[model samples]
Target: MKTINTNIAYKEEGTGEVLLLIHGFCGSSGYWGKVIPMLSEKYRVIAIDLPGHGESKALDSVKDIEQYALVLKDFLEELGIEKVTMFGHSLGGYITLGFAEKYNQYLRGFSLIHSTGFPDSEEAKKGRIASADKIEKAGIDIFIDGLVPKLFAPENVESHKQSMEEVKKIGYEVQPQGAKNALLAMKNRKDRTEILEKTELPVLLIAGESDQLIPADKTFTASGENIKQVVIEGAGHMSMYEAPEELGNAILTYLNHG
Candidate 1:
């Protein structure tokens, strides 16, 4: 594990083509604990704790998705990594699109895991703001506890109680300021469908069959010869935890076949 100057904490293991794992909202690099070792066996795996979450330092000012993308650019530059295949979950997915839009030259490929290229709807924007406000006023513990369960398919809440608790624990570790910044970034993100439609780079869109947040259709909306869609059965948004073996196999297949 190493920390970049901007306090981006990352864990790197194994060797081969670089595979960067970016966790979603309220998550840290630890979110990928179950799958990283499996993937690392085949490719160098670098999992990062985005600013304000896990061991990373919070940014002093509010930041956008592009800003986060730039942070990743700087982090990779610090590591002397010129290119990588990136897998982004949720918020990480938005940042991946931003990175692809501006730093496409550095990308070998990218995947959206339980994420969307669509910008927040007006109603969704309002909801994000409301939740941010609630987190600010009432604190993150209650907010995270209530929210983590919703991220799972309703049916999974009880079946995956231990995993849900791990998620909540990670959520509780998020810097409040960092959480606020992320919400704003997500709310303000521009739709990046154009990148999906035009890029020559390989793309993988993975959806959890029971995901309540970003459904399979939404994840699979963009079609292209370079794009591949995979639906993980009996899983939800937290498929990396709920179905790591299937998810790992899907990723391995994409990396090898793409």
Candidate 2:
């Protein structure tokens, strides 16, 4: 693994056609831990720690979703990866759509997992601002502990408490500034629904049937003719953790067929 400090910390893995995995806010490349081994069998999975999260340094200025997309563009160019299949989860998914809009030709396809293409609702944006304020006041650990439970369905939290705790630990490790910037980016993101219609490459939208964050109905509504939406039953926002095998299978099937 390598770390490149260009406002963000990026890590690369495996070797083949590059498939970039972007994690959600308060998440790191570790989110891909379960799915990487399966994907690495066929493609080079480049999982990145978006700025302010994971090992990446926090940005001095707040970044918008488009800026994050540009950062990924620069990261890819630096690695000499001309073409890629991008996978974004949650916040990562939002950035992936931005990338598709600006750099679609550079992508073989794009996948959005447990994410949304719609701009944040006023209430959601207000909530994000409130979250940022909480992180600034109570510290990252307290915020993470409070946030993790809401990230998954109630059944998942009940059955996978340990796993959920581990995820919370990872969230706690995240820098406060990074988490704050993520919230700012998310709140300021624009709706990129048109990209779904414009991009010729196949698009895959994966949502957990039980995910309350980016519900299946919203995902289906945003999907175009070129898009395929898959909802994993018994899974929540963190589907890869709740149903890794199923998520892995869906990804592999799409990659193989593409």
Candidate 3:
């Protein structure tokens, strides 16, 4: 585990070909905590906290998804990671798509977990602007409370109260500016379905059967011939946490087959 000067905080463990794990928006390297130990046994895992999240310094200018991708690219270059197998969740998945677009030769494969390749709908874009404005004005406290319930399944909220609370705490601690920047970037992200269509790189599309944010149907629509889709049953948007073992096995299986 190390913090690089690029304002990117990462944890590196085990050994083998590099596997970079990128967390979603409002998420940090912490999200990969459960899966890292298991993954480390097979591959050297580098879990990163995107700028403005976790231990990373907040950035003053990260207005779009490409900027996020550039930050990731810089982090890898700084570490001398020339080629990698990437596993990106949600917003991280979007960043992976951007990375593949610009640096496909540097990648062996990439996975999109509980994420989408479609651009934001007009309404979704409007909501993002409104959310960003609200975060800027009302602050993050209210936003954190309002967001937690929507992030997980109702069963988790009821049965896994402590885990849910920890997630909320992380969201609460997030820098408002970072959250705002992420929303702005997500709002402006281009439709990346064509990247999947054009690339020959192997892709693993991991979806939660009950994901509210990105439906299973949408995953199929976005997937191309080169993709292997894995749907985790009894999981929601937070599939990594909800079914870490299953997700880890799926990832390992993909890597093995590759």
* Full-model lDDT, candidate 3: 0.85
Superposition-based RMSD of candidate 3 using all C-alpha atoms, in angstroms: 1.3
User: Which regions of candidate 2 deviate over 4 angstroms?
Assistant: 5-7, 223-225
- Please write out the lDDT profile of model 3 over residues 1-258, one tens digit for every residue: 478779788899999999999988888888888899989997999999888888887898776888888898888899998999999999999999999998787799999998888899999999999998888888887887787666676666676677677777777768988999999899999999888777788889998887778887776555566788999987887877888899999999999986
Per-residue lDDT of model 2, residues 1-258, tens digit only = 467646556666678899999999899988888999998887888888888788888876647888888889988887778999999999999999999888887899999999878999999999999999999899999999888998888788889898798799779879998888888889989988777767779888898989978888777655556778788999989987999899999988888875
Q: List the residue pairs that clash in candidate 3.
A: none
lDDT, residue 147, candidate 1: 91
lDDT tens readout by residue for model 1, 125-235: 999999999999999998897799878877888889999999999999999999999999999999998888898999999999999889988788688889999999988
* Model 1 steric clash total: 0
True-vs-predicted CA distance for residue 192, candidate 2, Å:
0.8
Candidate 1 clash pair list = none
When 1 and 2 are scored with TM-score, the better candidate is 1
The per-candidate count of clashes, in order, stands at 0, 1, 0
Predictions ranked by lDDT, top down? 1, 2, 3
- Predicted structure 3: clash tally: 0
Candidate 3 lDDT score at position 141: 75
Name the regions of candidate 1 deviating beyond 4 angstroms. Answer: none
Best by TM-score: 1
